[model samples]
Target: MVFLIQKSQNKDSKAIHLKLSEIIASHQGTSNRMVNIEDLTELELDQLRKFYVQLSKLAAKEDA
Candidate 1:
């Protein structure tokens, strides 16, 4: 757990996966989790598009 946290301090993003069978067998959740970037719904995709647009504008403001 400490090693994972230390590793992530330098990266933009990290994805973690935990197997369902392992969790079921152990009766405990894995310390790793991830968002499936490929599985975004249409609405979520649109929201992300809008967010990048807004983020770009904010970045431009710093230059202006």
Candidate 2:
């Protein structure tokens, strides 16, 4: 039972990754670097998260 559950979860994760990759490829101005971003080390992902947070704040200030 444990093995079956793990298999299903893995399949779901792969499907989600593929869907996201397709979206990134189709969207204009979306960075190709974002494709396969799941492979990034945890620290690298954290840095990207922080960068986006700062960018969001800057955009908010511009809108004010």
Candidate 3:
């Protein structure tokens, strides 16, 4: 039962990832680098998270 549930969840996750990849590819300003973001290492994801946080701060400052 547990294995079946896990498999279903994995399938759903893959579908979601594919949909997001398609959206990223079709969007003009979106970064193609983000298409396979799930494959990034933990450290790389952390670095990207930090970069986005800083970007958010900068945007906030601009709005103020």
Q: State every prediction's TM-score relative to the real structure.
A: 0.43, 0.57, 0.56
User: How do the residues 5-53 of candidate 2 rate in per-residue lDDT, one tens digit apiece?
Assistant: 8866765565455445445445475556666666665566557656655
> Residue by residue across 1-64, what tens digits does model 3's lDDT show?
9998886676556545544544544536655666666666556655765665576687689999
Local distance difference test scores for all models:
0.43, 0.61, 0.61
lDDT of 1 at 6: 70
Q: Tell me how far the alpha carbon of residue 10 in candidate 2 is from the true structure, in angstroms, after superposition.
A: 14
Task: Quantify how close model 3 is to the true structure by its C-alpha RMSD in Å.
Answer: 6.1
Off by more than 4 A, model 3: 1-28
Instruction: Give the local distance difference test score of model 3.
Output: 0.61
lDDT of 3 at 8: 62
| lDDT (tens digit, per residue) of candidate 1 on 13-62 | 21111123223324355423223533544455456546555766876898
Off by over 4 Å in 1: 1-35
